[model samples]
Target: MKKQTINQKIEIHASAEKVWQVMWNNDSYKKWAAAFMPGSHYVGDLKPGGRIQFLDPSNNGMESDVESVTKNQEVTFRHLFELEAGNAGKTLGDMREKFELVEKDDVTTLFVSSDMPEEYFEEMNTATTSALQIIKEMSEQ
Candidate 1:
């Protein structure tokens, strides 16, 4: 399947740390990620080389490796394969997701870039946009 990169960004009236927390913290993550899939969540570490699974309620999702992480500044995940019933399935076509946060005067600009299958581009784009709005609202609070 063909793949394309989708990028989304939002400015939050909060510090980079606050934005980061809202994006990665388990509780807040579920709220924003619900835009993609209901009961979505991640399991595993966030450091380089750590293995992570982004799963929905049925344990079906993507398995990835943390390519890099820099606390409140940046984080990247390289998707390896699709997870079916909590098991590794087909390869994910070199998909990757990255998040970058830039802060100035306590305001944080959060940028998200992800590689996804062409067929799902439009749907993912809308979901990402809604997810960012959720994150912005949570971070500001």
Candidate 2:
């Protein structure tokens, strides 16, 4: 069966740059990403093609490859695998996620899309939406 893309979006009353910062900046990332996994943070720069280790407070989570990045516009990442007690496990399937930001007249529409296996579609869709909502609240502050 062909996998479907899970898309989520939110409009924030802030500049695209501000929205981008809230989405990527470490501290802010942890705050907004709490919806996905509480106390989540990453260990790596978000540059294109870089490897980022996404971790919870106990250092258990997954890692992803930064596929592409466009300042204040878009960013893409591909899931690699899960880590437990510092050990890497099987991959999280073939999944890719993208975050796009479009600004018009002062409101920025942030769109997040992810392509993953069908079984995980609904849960991740809900999590992504919650994350975006938190990001919107943070950026509008």
For each candidate in turn, the TM-score is: 0.97, 0.90
User: What ranges in model 2 sit over 4 Å off?
Assistant: 1-4
Please, what are the lDDT tens digits per residue for candidate 2 over residues 9-93?
8899999999999988888999988988898889987899899998988889888999999999999999888788557976777
Off by over 4 Å in 1: none
**What is candidate 1's CA lDDT for residue 74?**
99
lDDT of 1 by residue, 52-137 (tens): 99999999999999999999999999999999999989898788999999999878999999999898899999999999999999
- Please give the lDDT score at residue 141 for candidate 2: 92
* Angstrom error at residue 133, model 1: 0.1
Relative to the true structure, how large is the alpha-carbon lDDT of every model? 0.94, 0.87
